[model samples]
Target: MTPSLLEALHWSTMDISGAEYRGKEVPLLVVPTRYLLKLDTTMISYCDMQRVLFEEEKSAYNQAMQQNICDGKIHPLTSIHHTSTYNSLCKLMEYCLSPAVTTLQDRLKENELRLSMLQEEAKQLEADTQNMRNGSPRRLMNHGAGGKSSPTAQSRHPFSNQGSPRSPSGGSRRRAC
Candidate 1:
């Protein structure tokens, strides 16, 4: 809802709890809406009315609809079915429903769009994973008993040869104190 909408619809207040016209409860919830549409129609009614089309005047009209009515719930109207009153009310219904319908349609369209995008992304990832698996080698060694490296490679540098038989000291000679 916008202030222009309320202004276009000629709505003075948003609260409608105690609104009455000629002693009858006048449902003002739709008054602002009615006035908005009425303004739109009136502007377009005569060829020389110098009014802009709805789309052109949409911003202003929408602003009017956003007007808030605070605290004042009860209102008394002097007359019912005045030409201005009827037109304003009717416009309210048309404008309110129009945006709602558009919003619902847009949401559904966006949901469908996102669903398609996600599906495509999932398919691409799955294909990439499958390709990597197919290209990689399958054989793998477990690091248990037979598969373990020689102690020389695992513990000391191979070139150092601290325990090699080629050393000057015999392999069984214990070191002297």
Candidate 2:
């Protein structure tokens, strides 16, 4: 039955070159040739297609309008009055902050003045330290001396007591044998 259908459909051939179908050569007969013309069933009329395109365009336009409305709602500062108010608030903030800036500037000036005074004091202390290092004969005196001595005299008489009383024991005495 399927071979008859294939023969009817012109799909079966009589030329069998292989032994597998040697005894099964189809008889040559007048088979009608059929050509299938492609029919586009999904195509609509031109007017209907244009109507669908118009609907899509309309939906896109509506969506854009809705987006613009939403944007306007999200930022209500789209008006000139709101912009002017925002600028005024900024100016007010600057005005409120000016006093703090002035106070900080005054404090900075005072601190600079104090720093200069302290630097002058430090310079004076350094000068005083240098004078003490260079200016006193008594500053170089030895531990037990009462009078100030020059460097040469102190060097020449290194062990002189300069009027300190001697001990009665004379420091230490050895016994005579």
TM-score of each: 0.26, 0.33
| Model 2: ten consecutive residues of lowest lDDT | 35-44
Over 4 Å off, model 1: 1-94, 137-177
For residues 1-177, what per-residue lDDT tens digits would candidate 1 score against the true structure? 798987856654544535876766777554555556653345335423222333434554344433322353322231222335445755765575566557657878998999997786667557546655766422211221233434533343443233333324655664543
**Which candidate leads in lDDT?**
2
- What TM-score should be assigned to candidate 1? 0.26
How far does residue 110 in candidate 1 sit from its true spot (Å)? 1.9
User: Model 2 over residues 46-127: C-alpha lDDT tens digits?
Assistant: 3355456556655754564455566356344434444465456556655755665576678789999999977866675575
